[model samples]
Target: MSAVMITRKVRKWEKLPGKNTFCCDGRVMMARQKGVFYLTLFLIVGTCSLFFAFECPYLAVHLSPTIPVFAIVLFLFVLAMLLRTSFSDPGVLPRALQEEATFIEMEIEAANGNVPAGQRPPPRIRNVQINNQIVKLKYCYTCKIFRPPRASHCSICDNCVDRFDHHCPWVGNCVGKRNYRYFYLFTLSLSLLTIYIFTFDIVHVVMRSVDNGFLNTLKETPGTVLEVLVCFFTLWSVVGLTGFHTYLLSLNQTTNEDIKGSWSGKNRVQNPYSHKNIIKNCCEVLCGPTYPSVLDRRGLTQEDLPVPVASAAPSSSSSSSSPVPQTTHAVLCLQKTKAPLIPNKRTPDDAKPSIAASAQKSPSPKEENPPAPKAPPLASPEMDVETSINKDKTH
Candidate 1:
């Protein structure tokens, strides 16, 4: 059937003998590693800028004091833009999501009325309260078991992902358990770099204000004006971006979720990915040891699981729509029924009657004759009666 295969309760990070690493070969790790390359570029630009602006007076005549700052800012902005692009189109990876199971339940529905003895029904997703907050859970259809919070099926990767974040093209990987914090850090640092450069150049330009006289004197200042243009552009971008990320951080959202339109009224309370403590969560996701691992995961128990008893068959308290073990919702489904096909018969209204007979039967409208007009009255004495009588006599 080309159905995927899965190993239950086995995590993504567990080490088997002779394996080199316990990780998805996805780009999240690689892109995060590449961020260092950008950092190095920033440093090199900073050195050059400093030498031109301060150390070398000869170059200072051509470059502004904030040139180094401008360079750093420009580099950061380009890096951020590239990263954003990368995040937008992440490639595929080979991995499976994992979660802990605390309870078990099973239900079955016949496929084409051919029942398999003791075969479990398909898994359903559910919502549950964890540590006083609601998080979603799901069943892994391939594994025939329920999965825990933050688990997802990666179609490209062809398996469920634990703590699943969206795939990013910039990192060329899925932003899940591990590289989430690094993603945030990359955005923040880029924003700061842009703002710093913008502020410095703006101040410098204003200080060097020239008299217009009869011509625009600002053009007299020498060399490439790219620095000024770059500064203004970065200023607008950084200010807007910083404001946006601050809000997302407060609400604990990813760029991927923001664009994917996943937020709901219940997101604040029901979101499993929100930081338990904003600061602590950021630390864990960014630079801490808390990346999502298939191994060492936890999940919900069976006693609290909600089983959707069929309304038609209420005595079967655990119906085919029972929630998966670690998840919080039922996998709702419609029962399939096949009815015998019957050919449609034409009614009197639908039948084609004689068109000529219908046309001849229609009533015709009757025509009425018009009445003749009355003659005009003769000319009176109050008018020019003599002239009227003369004219009538001539006629």
Candidate 2:
């Protein structure tokens, strides 16, 4: 009878070691650390609540009724964009499976003359031409593959993301190929919403101040005052972020690429991804076909299932009769070892001591060990007797 292997049936998300939090049984996902994101949510919700409570009523009653409706519409849009940016997959490139990783390693070795594992490895990089220009793709140790062009590893997420822009704590998610558009839209709408609320609050104040003096108007509705104060401080940062991302969007460049100056003047590089036309760039990024999430997080995994003994075992006469070895998953682990301190080849100075030690251990042909000195011939028994007699006479 053949031995059997029993294992748990689990979802893919259950097995991943990523630093992400999943909810709704793997339907929702986000970074595990969300202190900043919680703060962001509080600020947005609180500010909107204050606006709807204190300012919207006065503006709707005094001015056109549509003022409140417009604000509501814009507010919902902003919230939707924010949530989309936060929850959607940010173009994560899944780590290579065992078979794929092994194949890549073999290809790298073969291309680089099969360098010895104990010796220095060849640079894990490959160059590919894109849009009539060359770009270097680097190997990611964590992903165990040459990173796709523009893709980078996020230390925070502990995952390699395709066309990575940046990790945004504000959204509690990464901005990358998948969600960059949503992130940009969120920032843009958030800044606009702040400005809209701030401007109307002032108008509401002015309208009331005409009937009552300015100081008296401030004293009557203090929530309006507080809303203005909150919006005042938050306005600049959100506006600035929006402006910067607009520039990036027009150029078809990521925040990561911009910060690194990848396609900048001194580097003498050009962005291959750029359409070289503003409208095209905007349309391509915003309206491009969306890709499905590569990580099948919700999918079930079945592995290492044992075969029935009768089916698995062959005839006793057959030497090849054997069930497939029990399977095990291979996980890519982070390295803790430091690089070598010295070069592989030894220098003359380094070799001198070894050479001297070798010389001392081995004798020269001319300095072979000499034979032991011969002992003086022993006296015969008669000579010994004569010597004994002479000794007696002398005594």
Candidate 3:
């Protein structure tokens, strides 16, 4: 008899190590480490920005005295927004909500009926019907909940973030529901600052060239050159980011949802979330509406989204039908089932009738047979005989 290894599938809702807590402690620690890097960058950028705006001789000589003050104030505002975006909690699901989800999950599981001990529960697909159309929402096994529309599990943060944009390594945080407005503001402000600095640098350089020869201007105003180069290099990313967010705001879409192609289909030219008014969509994102508030504004509830439903029961004409493909989770569960310990001694011809009989049997919810015990690999007669011989020799 070959050894059978039976491994049970761990349900996501079940309390497990590293998953039971609302906040993943390890991820928090890593975020803190990344925070330090971002802070360092911010400080360095701030120092350079201030120095070039005020201390650079060409800028001081040519630019109006009020320009530096305006630039500094704008720079500070940008920094403040950046800090808020980086440190603010990015809409982690509340403990109360988690409890609610768990309760709902239990009810769903019960309604589906108890799965046999060795078998996996069928995949529960949840969906919402809107205007006679079905929209699907993904389930996160790690969070043990169906993610809301526009929400996604950030692998870096190890949390499901509502209205997830993307994790900004430069900001050292996720731009999500609560802080996306701040993130957008930060990007916009930074872009304006770069353009402001770049503009003044160009003016200073041009003025200096007319007064002092071009080569002499370059040599004399090296700080101006450095500032120009820095702003020039960084402007594209800052401007592009701001522009991309603007487009997203106009359409009322998150970076994740947009990239996943969830909003586009043959049935509609515009996404449901898009309010049809660009100004209204922009206000919704920039004003920092809560998830429920956003949902309410759109006349939707959390449950309004679609999720995968549990598969229908097999039909009575079982023997004639082809087998359905199993879900990923179910396939994994089937793969982990224990092998029969005692090899079938019966010939293939003898086993054919039994296989056919089992196939003909219809599945029933009322059936509750306990899983049979798996035999150990050592239970084979040859292994047993060898074990006995070895014991006798030792004695």
Candidate 4:
């Protein structure tokens, strides 16, 4: 197929309102809701942490004066990372680039004899084996393009993200190629903050118990009790998340890939992008150029590259007949035709007549006889006798 034909097909399939116009009604609402949720979490955590840091008598009397300042700095870092992750772009594919890719794919398909001239086939999933592991790449019918490796369509974001990790409600955004480093940093910082708070609370409570008694300290500082409980629970979650991401960084895998068992084969010794250096992998994920590095490794440069689009595997049938071409008229015809309803057994009188039978059985309106005209009513008996007398006198 020609490039023009392919472009027309892609445009026809997408049917978007305008070029690069994303419907913002639902997306805007979700973004606002997430913003509110993040703000609420920040306020709650910050207020509680600061309140305990300043008001707790144990800290005021025994802890170093710089502890509160350190706590404040950590809190600010957490907020900064959260904000950065939430607002940064998550490597959305450009509309122009996507169209170019579609055209290239069409040309490749034509060269391979998969699609005939001036016709487009329905997108199919292609299974590729890399590093002894099967990776299933899918074409996005909505976007009219094949998804890149390590990329996924986020239903929440309503876009395909490059190197997608997961949509985190806490951060209110996807942890993807652009912001993954910030996300990791945020997790790590939050974990450390939680650990620090938990330790400080425990130490303060112990000090109070030593000064007074265990039971008296509990009674005197009830706020400390609530703070300690909160820190203990939050510590577990943050620490667990930090540890999981650390492991993923070491393996150079995304959470999405890990969960989907993308690297679960026994023969898999290394990742496709692995330089066989753990330090290099970590640096690439944490400090190196984000989207460009990944795209470069996959041979998809900033400018379009001549990548071969793999055709779908042929069916097992030995027949060599050319495939039928799909047209708009055929699709409309299929939609116009309704499915036949099941026939039910019925009594002779209850049976409904078929269309042909009804046409033959019923009389035409013109052929049927019309009703007779009605006669006028007679006069009352006394009025009739009076009328007769008057008629005789007149005669």
Candidate topping TM-score: 2
Candidate 2's residue-wise lDDT over 27-143, tens digit each?
Answer: 777887788988999988888888899888888888888988988888999999988988888988888899999999888878889666689877899999998999999999888
In terms of lDDT, the poorest run of 10 residues in model 4 is 4-13
What is candidate 3's lDDT per residue for 168-189, written digit by digit as tens?
Answer: 8787777888888888998898
Candidate numbers, best TM-score first, in rank order: 2, 3, 4, 1
Q: Which lDDT value does model 3 have at 241?
A: 87
Candidate 1 stretches with Cα past 4 Å from truth are: 1-123, 126-129, 132-134, 139-148, 153-161, 170-172, 207-224, 234-238, 255-263, 266-287, 290-395
Superposition error at 172 for model 3 (Å): 0.5
Which candidate wins on lDDT?
A: 2
Question: TM-scores for all candidates?
Answer: 0.42, 0.73, 0.59, 0.58
Q: Rate the local accuracy (lDDT) of all candidates.
A: 0.47, 0.85, 0.67, 0.66
lDDT for 28 in candidate 4 is: 17
TM-score between model 4 and native = 0.58
Q: What is candidate 2's CA lDDT for residue 140?
A: 92
Better of 1 and 2 by TM-score: 2
For each of the candidates, the C-alpha root-mean-square deviation to the true structure, in angstroms, is 28.4, 26.8, 26.6, 21.8
lDDT at position 200, candidate 2: 92
